[model samples]
Each structure stands twice: as C-alpha cells, then as structure tokens.
Target: MYPASYYYRRRLPGRSRGKGLIICLIVFLMFSTGIGLLKLINIQQAIPKFPLLILGQKGENALNLMCSAMPLLPVSIELNDESNNQSSIQLADILVLRLSRVFRLDRQSPIALLEKELPVPVEVESSAVPVMKAAPVLPNPPSPEPEEPRQAQVPTLSEECLMAVYNTHTGETYALTDGMDRLQGKKGGVVQAAAALEEELEKKLGIRVARSDAINDDVYQYSYAKSKAVLEKLLAENSQIVAAFDVHRDAGKSREESIVNIDGEILAPILIIVGSDARAEFPGWQNNYQFAKKLASEINKQYPGLCLGVMVKDGRYNQFLHPRALLLEIGSVSNSTEEAVQSARLLGKVLGPLIREIYENKQSE
Candidate 1:
C-alpha cells in the first residue's frame, strides 16, 4: 500500500477517458440517426401524391388535378354530396389507403397510417380494376332535305264501244263436227258459231266484243238461271254493252224449218225470240220485242230470207235485264255446224251496223 491516492489517480484517468469516449460515441450515433430520419421524412413530403383523374358523365370535363405519371383508371366515385369539399378529401384519403394496402406499402407509410385512422371499412378489390381509354371527339352531322308529294293516276275509257256475247246452254255441242252428242260437254257447235260471230264482229266490222267461254251449268235444266247470273255480271262490268244475244240450236225441230240458202251457200236460219211473260218479272218485254223486230228486219235486208221472223214466248230468259236482249236460235239439231257458223258470220255483219246505229241514236238523244 504505497499510498491509496496514487492507485486511485492512475485508474481514474483510464476509466474516465473510456467512459467519455463511449458517451461521445453514443451521442454521435443518436444525432446521426435523428438527422437521417428527418431527411427521409422531407424526401417523402417532397414527392408529389398521385392525382386521381375523375371523369364526368359526358367525358368532356375533368374533376381533379392532371398528373402525367399516374395511370388513368375508370373508377366511379359517386359522391352524392360532392358539393361538400370535406367528403371529397375523405374519399381521396380512402382511395390512397386502398392503394397502399394493394401495393403492400411500408408500415410507416403515410397512406398506411391514414388507413388505420379512417372509420369506414376498407374493402379493396384487387381483381376489378378498370383501365380507362380517352374518349374520341367527333364532328357534327349534316341536316336532311324535304321530300315532294306524289300525284294520283286516273283510268281512261275505251274509244271503241264494247259488246258482250255468252252462251246460256254452253253444253249444247254439235253432232258430226264435235264427235258424239250435241246436248252435253262445253265444246259445243253453238260455242263455235258464237266465237266465229265474235271474230267477224271484231275483225271485219271493227267492233270490240267480249265473249264468255264459261260453262254456266253442266246440267241443261238449270242453264237459263245460271246464264242469267253471267249476263248480269257482263252488263255490270261493261257499261258500253248495247245488246246481249243468247245463241242456241233448236232441238227436235225439222231441218227444213231451220235451214236456208244464201248466194249458193247452205246456211242455218236465224230465229229471233222475244220473251213476253209479264208475270215472270219481264214488264219490259214489249221493248225487247221491238229490238228483235228491228234486228230481224235488218238481217232479212242484208241476206234476203236468212231470218225466220220473230217468235213471241212466255218466259223471262233474263230479257228484263236489258231492252236489246234476244234469244236467237241459229238452226235445228239436224243442221250442220258449218251452216250455223256461216249464219253467225252473216249475222255479225248486219248486227254490227245495227248496234252502231242504236248507239249513235242514244248518243244523239
């Protein structure tokens, strides 16, 4: 023990120097850590927050600050109370918090801190993120022109007058010309005679004739009734029809009674029949008789003795429908079809002139 003061002084210098070095090192370390933390905070504050672009319904206006780095996303942020600026800020904060959670940000991130402080539930859907494309601008379209009104068309009446010819007993056929019976089938001798008359009236006399090829009734008993309907239809359709003739061949009558000869050519005699049955709805039978008389007289003047005179009967025969209605028996069943055809042609020649005269008289009246 050389002295207690000497040992104490020697140990004290070393210990004091060691303690001072440790304290200075601790202070320096704390100061450096604090300075580094402050620098990090400043850098974070300096970096700009990503601006969210909100598009309006029309897509012609923007709702937030424009940022070049931030990618555009089609997000519908329906802030019904958008007039309040506080609600808008709260929504932005919520969006940032969701982004921070999705990107797995650092625990000390400002966005993450905000997420913890927010009162609303933070449900981030990582799958439903929509990428938005900028809308294209279009030019205005041109207006349309007005259309014109259309005109209506009118129907014109024929220059030449028309005549209607039809067969009452359409099934009355010929014997030798059209094989088999004369009282059955449509291809009858009377039909052929009427067609020849129609052709002569049209081609030779320049008359417009409408002849019906309709088989009125298959059964001969109901022929007159059925033919009346056909005649009515013809007269209704053609207002120009001046006369209607029902051509037929007399059955079971003598050949001498029905045949005639004109200029060395054998002919079928034409008989003009006038219906005079006042009780059968024919009050205008006298007018029909007068027409028959005139027509018969004309036929006789043209071919001398071709007509066998007029016969007054007691049946309507649809003569009441028109004053010029005539039931003409061309020939008997025994007479040949060639004779009947010749008679029909001769009739057309005389009848065409008579019809023109009657029409002219009516027009003059």
Candidate 2:
C-alpha cells in the first residue's frame, strides 16, 4: 500500500547496508589477526607450533621452479625417521617430488634437501625407482629386502675403484631358463652375473669395481675383437685397475653337468681362462697364467673343484691388456641366472680376501 518508488528505494538501501556490514566484519577480523601476529616477537618459538609458516610452505614453490632446468644428480643421503614429525617430512618430500619432473636427480644437489635421503649401498636409479629391472626371460621374483645388503659398506675403508670386470659375450643367455641361448645384440645372463659380481663385491668387501655393459657378442665370432676395444678404453680411463676379468659363458653344457657342489650348495662352475701369445702379442701372458692358477687354487681351497681349473687358450682373450687380466667362463647356456649369480657371488666371497691382499700389497709398493 506504499508508493512504487518508495519501496524500490527502501530495498536498494537495505541491500547496501548488508554489504557494508560484511566489509566491516571482514576488516575487523583481518586487523585482529595482524595485531595478534605482531605481538609474538619470539618467531623461533612459534616455528614448533606452526611449521608451514616459514620455509616449508614458501620454499616449496620456489624449489619447484628451480629444479625445472637443473641437471641430473647422484645423491648420498640418510633420512631421519626418529621423530614424530616423520609424517610431516614424508608429506613434504611427496609434495616436492610430485611438483616437478624436470630433474633426473640422483646426485647431490641443492634440491636434494626437499627429498628424503637414501644410503648409497644398493643400486638406485636416477630417480626414486630401482635400477635393476627383471629381464624378460628370468622370472622376476619379489625382491626381498635383505638385512645383509643394508649393512654392505664397510665403515673403515678407502673407497677406491680397485678392479675392472666386463662381459665380452654379454649376449650369452641361459636357454633352459631365458628361452634362448644368446640374445644376439641384447644383454644376457653373463651380463647379469657380472653385475651381480660387481654388487656383491661392493657389498661384501666394499671394493669399488668398474664394470662394463659393452655388447660385444652380436656377431659371436668378433666378440673378443670388439671387447678388446672396450677393455682398452676402460683400462685407459681407470689406470689404477690392476686386475680385469672378461666374463663369458660356455655353451653346449646342461645345468646338471655345469654345476659344482660348494659347501653343500649347488652353484655353477667357474673356469679361469688364460690367453696365449699364439694369436696376439701378449708379453706378460705367463704372469696372467700364474695369477689364474693362484685364483683357481683359491677357489678350489674354498670349495674343491668349484673352479674347473685354469684353461690356457691359443687366442689372446684380451689378457694382453693387463698383467692381472684373465677370462672367466661363468657357466654354460643351460645354467639359470640364479645359479650364475650365486656362482658370481661365491667368486666375490672368495675374491675379497685375495683382492684385498693384492690391493694392499700393491699400495704398499
């Protein structure tokens, strides 16, 4: 029953009043918070109550922007899980790891602080994932995180690369297990055994062994020829490598016939091969032969006949590269990767004592 203009004007003024009330309430709340924050002069004490107020919140966004153009890294870190704040730390690493994909970071870097640290014992990839992938042929068993592997690195030791190992015929596979005897151009069981030997030696003895993944068996006959080149390069770079082994596989032998009983456990046989001067100019071939003999004797002493004795070949299997260089036929084509790996591990077990002897003696000289 009022005039039309009067009602319209009244409604507009009521809406304006409501908006002003909201603005005033919001300003009052903000002003109160600012005054409360200003009262706390001891900012350090406040950090415990409110962690996300400082670097943990603001630095994360900046870290993401920084690692976008950074290089790959190899990190040696140890995560501290001894506090109740482990969950928060983990959440922080997750946020940072999920934020940027630009860094293939494994090495030590400034951005590494955002991630949890891991010991450089077991092999790790450039990222968080493991480096070892199950071969298509070998049944990928669930990798049990063994305790021994964690206690791998010896506390008192000078970490130096002491030995070099490579596979001349990396394509030699286990036919019974791998569905093929050789992989032609791909890495085979021999390569895996060599890798196992590297890891085992590092774990058990803390000896840094330089190993190669050079695929030299693509053509089979030219394997030695190609591997010689790889060996030359490796030895040239690592001049301190006094000992080298050309890891290979022997064909035409079954699993049963290729094994040796060592300490009640069945392991693949190892054959030490010494090259001759008949094919190539090998000056110190006999020294290598004597070393091979000593190595064979050591293996035999540990587990009699585990080594199939040292075999001297007419061809210079790249033994001419170094005085301590020798060839090792890990197992036959019929041997499984497990057997091969165990055998290689056994070799590492025995080699630790003799290797330390050789190394320490050389260092004294």
The residue-by-residue lDDT of candidate 2 on 93-199, one tens digit each, is: 43334323323443223224223222113324568976797768968889987666355347423466778999988888777578888887999888899998888
Cα lDDT for residue 58, candidate 1:
29
The residue pairs that clash in candidate 2, if any, are 73-106, 73-107, 74-106, 74-107, 74-108, 75-106, 75-107
Give the Å shift of residue 25 in candidate 2: 65
lDDT of 1: 0.69
Please give the clash total of every predicted structure, in order. Answer: 1, 7
- Candidate 1: list runs displaced more than 4 Å: 1-161, 179-183
Cα lDDT of model 2 overall? 0.70
